[model samples]
Target chain A: DAGITQSPRYKITETGRQVTLMCHQTWSHSYMFWYRQDLGHGLRLIYYSAAADITDKGEVPDGYVVSRSKTENFPLTLESATRSQTSVYFCASSENRLQETQYFGPGTRLLVL
Target chain B: LAKTTQPISMDSYEGQEVNITCSHNNIATNDYITWYQQFPSQGPRFIIQGYKTKVTNEVASLFIPADRKSSTLSLPRVSLSDTAVYYCLVAPPAGYGGSQGNLIFGKGTKLSVKP
Candidate 1:
């Protein structure tokens, strides 16, 4: 497809395990972001990359790691998964312009036991 | 960063006009108002954006006053398919290097359009 996609649409893991959610976009947008949607938190940003190799922490970046080696791919890794990390993860991309629109992926549902 | 406040939920009948307003009393000079719509289990989609006055697009219209304290998203003749959670966002000003705007989403107003 032409839009963004996240791999392993559903995942299950145990505590202390390492898991990664993959995000890839065809638009080659310079800005890629990862957000976790929980019951009351709405969408809390985990990490965002302005361009390849430049990533910044967002509101809830604890225990989550992100890297953007390529403009089209930004993978989010949980070093040590916990029960609190279970949420619907969404990946979004946008062009490098102020007030630009962000296109979101279908989201990855992760369940940590 | 500007904080936003909106109603928790609303209901309307099909073929009726719907307007959801957001209050941003502390909006900055360069802040822009934007609205997004999200269906259940789906990502939010951009509907409209405006800096001042009124800006209309195919899906919706955004009205902003001169003081920039608030904005309203108008959906004309909404249908059953228009039932979704509408988010009103206040974007950070430009000149900070085009990064991903940290969208502080308030509890969005869930509009249920009855058929």
Candidate 2:
């Protein structure tokens, strides 16, 4: 109900299908970020939003897209799901982009079948 | 952002104090060292942060030497529940086309506390 939350905690999709993972934060934080975590590695940033209507690419952002139309929302989209896209996606938010800790959501486990 | 190096894994006994060190030889003056703890199936949670010297909180302690090239995360009286991955990170100021919140999470130290 509060903090950051992600929708469809678990998702299943096939190749070539479009999928969207939703993230919401009640804190109205100024920054939101999307990350994907796969096996044998750490969390890699896919995209980040400094504020509403301002988003930037991170380490990995090829097949993923993100938008921040409102201060409390940032959603990630995959135009065409692929097996390699299957991973635990996490959404994070922070009051400001500088000198602050990023708070994370539980994560959305997507399985591309 | 400076590159960081840390142990791939560690083993410790329950009720023992555990310390995981990270090396960042190229750290900049504007960078701050931070640590995060993550359990399986969950996102990382911030443990402690330090600009230099040492910082402590209810969760853990962060020790940064004067050189700032290295830092250690100290976990006190660890228990089985403390077993998790610990990430060490450094971020430049937001002026460098990067926000402090835009952290780089490298392969963290997987700490296994045995009973």
Candidate 3:
């Protein structure tokens, strides 16, 4: 399958534990993004990477960390998870084209107790 | 960041044409409007994109008026399968290198298609 994928599609953790969500894409898209979808907030960008070793903050980057050591992978980590951080996280990739159409992975549903 | 406003939800029956409008009063000149369809428990899929005027693909049609402050997505002959949330996003010009551009996806319009 030549598409984006997220590992640990479903996750559960305690309030103070650390958690990491992995994202990988086969298309070698230069741009990768992480977004959290909550009930009323919709999709808020947490972080994004332009290429390997180049990451930037997004709309809601607090309490989250992201790294792109390789072009195909962008992993997001929660240093200390909180119940407020529980939401569906989506990873997307896109080329630097004029349209910049983003292709999203299935998603990772995180639940913090 | 250019903010977009769309309906909270809409309802339609099968074989009917449905149009969902989104308002982006702060759209920039170089920005582009894109629509994505998201089904429950899944990610969003790009449906269409347009700058101005009308753009149509096999899936749907996007109409951006001359002012570009708003856009409409038209789904023809919608079926039960077309029931999903549609997000209208205003994306800034593609950034180079490390510059981060905004693609704000607000609470999308949930279209409910029934028999």
Candidate 4:
């Protein structure tokens, strides 16, 4: 109840459909991030939010959109899902930048056909 | 932001000390070395962090030399449960914003502890 949570832990969506991955954190951390993990590439950051209403793109942001309306919620949206987008997505939060420890959600496994 | 390099994989017998070294040649003055351990299908959990010299915790120890160009994560008497991917990251100080300011992950060293 007090940690980060991701909704729809497992999802299967058709290509070209829109999908959204939800991330909620109870810690009220200022920094929130979304990362996608694949077998060969490891973990690649997709987006990060510094605070409410401030979000920036990370290493891999194409075809994805992120919005942070409140400190507790940062949602990632895929406008047109592709098969290449299939991966395990992780959401993490930290109180501030620097050496702060990041608490992560369980992760959302998405499969696109 | 500094890029780190580490071994791709390693294996060790159980109850043996395992040391995984990470090299960060361009580490900044304010950067801090941090390590995280991740089991399969789970997000990485913070192991230990250090700025210089040595820092030990209940889980593991972080060793940084005077040059600050590299750091080592030493897990004493590792067991099968300790088998996981260990990531070494160089994090910037607070309020540093940039594309690379975020935690940049490397391939990570996969340590398999066998009994």
Which candidate leads the pack in DockQ? 3
Model 4 docking tier (incorrect/acceptable/medium/high) = medium
Rank by TM-score (best first): 3, 4, 2, 1
Q: Identify the leading candidate in terms of lDDT.
A: 3
Residue-wise C-alpha lDDT for candidate 3, range B50-70, written one tens digit per residue: 999999999899999999999
Ranking by lDDT: 3, 4, 2, 1
Query: Which of the CAPRI classes, incorrect, acceptable, medium or high, describes model 1?
Result: medium
Give the per-residue lDDT digits (tens) of candidate 4, residues A1-113: 69999988999999999999999999889999999989867778898888999888777899999999999999999999999999999999989874678888989999999
- The runs of at least 3 residues in candidate 4 whose Cα sits more than 4 Å from the true structure, single-residue gaps closed, are B96-101
Judged by whole-model lDDT over C-alpha atoms, candidate 2 comes out at: 0.86
Task: For candidate 2, give the lDDT of residue A6.
Answer: 96
Clashing pairs in 4: none
If both were scored by TM-score, which would come out higher, candidate 1 or candidate 4?
4
Candidates in order have lDDT scores of 0.85, 0.86, 0.91, 0.88
Accuracy of chain B in candidate 1 (TM-score): 0.91
DockQ, in order, for the candidates? 0.50, 0.52, 0.62, 0.61
lDDT of each residue in B1-115, candidate 2, tens digit only: 5678889999999999999999988888888888888998888898888999989999788999999999999999999999999988786655324443346776799999999
Decide which is better by DockQ, 1 or 4: 4
The residue pairs in collision within model 3 are: none
Model 4: lDDT of residue B53: 98
TM-score of each: 0.93, 0.93, 0.96, 0.94
DockQ of 2: 0.52
Q: For model 1, what is the error of residue B91's alpha carbon versus the real structure, in angstroms, after optimal superposition?
A: 1.8
Q: Considering lDDT, which of the candidate structures 3 and 4 is the better prediction for this target?
A: 3
Output the better candidate (3/4) by DockQ: 3
